[model samples]
Target: MLKIRNLVGGYTNTPIINGVDFEISKGEFFVLLGPNGSGKSTIFKLITGQLPCQKGEISINDKSLSSFSKLEKAKKVAVLSQEVQISFDYTVEEIISLGRFPHQKGLFKTLSVEDKEVIEEVMEITKVKQYRDTQFRMISGGEKQRVLLAKVLAQQPEVLLLDEPTNHLDIKHTFQMLDLLKEWQQTKGLTIFAILHDLNVAALYADRIALLHKGSFLDVGDVDTLRKESQLETVYEVKVNAQSHPTVPKPQLLMTPNHSKTKSELLNFDTSFSITKNDQFIHVQFESPLRTISNGVIGEGIQWLKHFCNFHVEKHYNGSNPKQDLQKWMEKYEIPFEQSVAMMTAVRLEDVVIVTKQIEDIKVIAVVTAGTGNAVDITNSSLSQSHEKVGTINSMVFIDAHFTDGALVNGFMSATEAKVKALHDLNVKDPETNTMATSTSTDALLLAVTQQGKETQYAGSGTVVGKVIGQTVYEATHKAVQKYFHRLQK
Candidate 1:
């Protein structure tokens, strides 16, 4: 357990962590979060005694940090700061064994059986046992990070301090390492205090979160309370969209319109009937309405509903009968004309990490699907088929009247996140432990939208059920478009 009262510290005479107060219960995984220069790292420094404490007090297990001798603190608290520049090319086992030094008496201490067991256990948990004999410098940066973590674990301290532990890791390694840390915490009741840059990662593992900004504590509480978009925007001083993970209480972030990137970027939806912009850049506007439907063109579940605008309209099937021609194009382009699966995730225009060369002015739609299936049908699916490659998934759609293209290919993302996140938003522990549950459909539903046209473009695809979802939407949008276009004719 740890507590801080009116803590204040910083470099030189300037104060960074001013009047900060928070506490961590025993066995809690607490995280400090904030933008760069917000003093999260500085707070760690003050607590670790790396920098002299300017004001306030810090205590562990009701004992003042000031009162604990350096060696005593080493036994009680283990710190893994961001920087661990090694001067010697020590073997992985040698480095890990160093964590046991506090437990050893004066110099020339011999290894005890207990110490060797702890070292081996630490190596196994961190997955660096194989590298026990290898030099630390030979491994990749990410691997070395794991080694350092193992070393800290070998310390077997009561409290743990980690500074951006996952900064060097990729997505896969990040999860693996966190999994190790979590397992240790659960089994050993090791309390963690960390400063994390990635809010999503923090949300995934941290039991509680503290938000900081401009060298001040913006707020400190469980992730659910601080994950709201409004609070995030206020702290970041920018437009943002925050969503809680579906099954976890932690909040994820999506920065809005990359106003800094460029003003020329645009996204439109073509639903055959008409073309409408998904977002208009270069100014302030009201937030999007609570919901919008896509032609299942590009949408994630609980996905960004703003893109769903005006409803489905009837597509006059014209009976033009391009059956053979449509089939030919579908085959030629590797498009999935029938039931295809895809993933979609929506962030505000800004959060998107754009990669382009020509900057083709086009509309983008995201279609998504989320389902739990044990049925193994993997080998039979076509590997070449892709909606986006066929100029469909996450693309600009054209809307229409009396005729919907029903051709725009895409996947769903946001909606799936939102639906999954419902449990996460509750921020309740043991959500699944409640025995009784009710839900009939095992099928994953898709959401779509046509951006530019009125007729065929607005008409959707997939099963009869998929098309039925657009009924209400198409009906409303049909009227709205007819009235607008008809007015333009005048």
Candidate 2:
């Protein structure tokens, strides 16, 4: 546990830290975030007693930090600074063994069996055992960081201070270091205080974040509270967009780029598409890979792809695993599987419906192809159907507008709701459930956009973008569904 209240300090005649107040709960992974020269490293110095506090108090476990002796402080707190320089050619094992000096009688004292065991364990934990005899200067930058970390672990301190520990490391090493720290914090209840530049990294690991600006604490709270786009934009003096991580549900910040775009340049839509029809399939091509979100077989869910195909499969075609079949087809056709999105249906391409609408000067387009073979009313499905429909419905929405990824996700949700509402309006139902059918069992939806013009931040139900998606998808889907039912009657 660490506590700092009304903390003020800096070099004489030039104060760096303003009145700062915060507390780190026991065993909490707390992070400090700010731009360069925000006095983050200065705070570390004040806490470790390298720089004396001009005012206020810092305490560890209710004990004043100033009360601790050099050895006492070393035993309770360990710091890894932003840079570590090794001018001397010291062996990795020898460097790490120095951490045991605080516990021993003196630096020159004979090493004990317990010290050796701790050194071995720390080396193994940090994955530096193989480099034990190598000179610290001979290893890679990431290896040096790991070796230094092993030394700090050898100190057996309860509290660890990391100042941009991931700086200069590659992605792999950065993640490896943080993942190890997280594991240690959870398993050993090690308290950690770190300063990080990457907002996403802090969100992923920190229990709470403290934002510092110009030697003062701007805000301090949980990740979600401190990472508001407006707050971060003001603090960092840049445009910021907050979005959820696709897999983790954590808030991540993306810095908006600043540039000038003329009206003519902004209006130039770089997106173009071509649709080709064969006897058994329809191929859709894009001028470039579009940021697409879909449930199609190949390019399913939030990816960049340039091509898609809607194939006509037989009613009795093996449907046990559509993705597997798609994979086989892609390999046979020599397609770049990762760059393609594909779907299948018993209905022909001629039956697809395309609808276009304009909302608030933005253009929205919807393409829908429907089938009822696999439709089900999700409410009362206990009754077994005498026959199962093997058809599929595939829909695509394209917008001549720009959107943030978060807004795009919201647009997808709104579009789906509109499609189901269209079905309800048509009185479409599943005989088993006696309720309106929302979506078919194997339905696929694709959301794409030209990403031109002004940026739309939110696409919830009340937004203009949402309204356009609702109206266009509803009209298009209604027509497609009606066509499907008419074909069924025939």
Evaluate model 1: give its TM-score: 0.61
> What is the clash count of model 2?
1
Give candidate 2's TM-score. Answer: 0.86
Q: Can you write out model 2's per-residue Cα lDDT over 296-365, one digit (the tens) per residue?
A: 8768877768787777777667688988887787677666677888888777667888888986778887
Per-candidate Cα lDDT values, in order, are 0.56, 0.83
Model 1 C-alpha lDDT per residue in residues 1-490, reported as the tens digit of each score: 7999898889989887788899999999999988777888889989888888888989998889899887898899999976767999899999999999888875887778899999998888788899999998888888888989988888889999999998888899889988888888899899999998777788788889988887677777787745577878777676876666687655777776754413232222231222222322111111221122333322333332332221111122222433443334334545333322122212122221211111123233222111111111223332332211111112222221122223332122322323333223322122123221111012133343322222233322342222433332233222322333343356
Per-residue error (Å), model 2, residue 106: 6.9
Query: Which regions in candidate 2 have their CA more than 4 angstroms from the true location?
Result: 106-108, 260-271, 288-293, 298-308, 318-321, 331-341, 356-362, 383-388, 402-439, 454-490
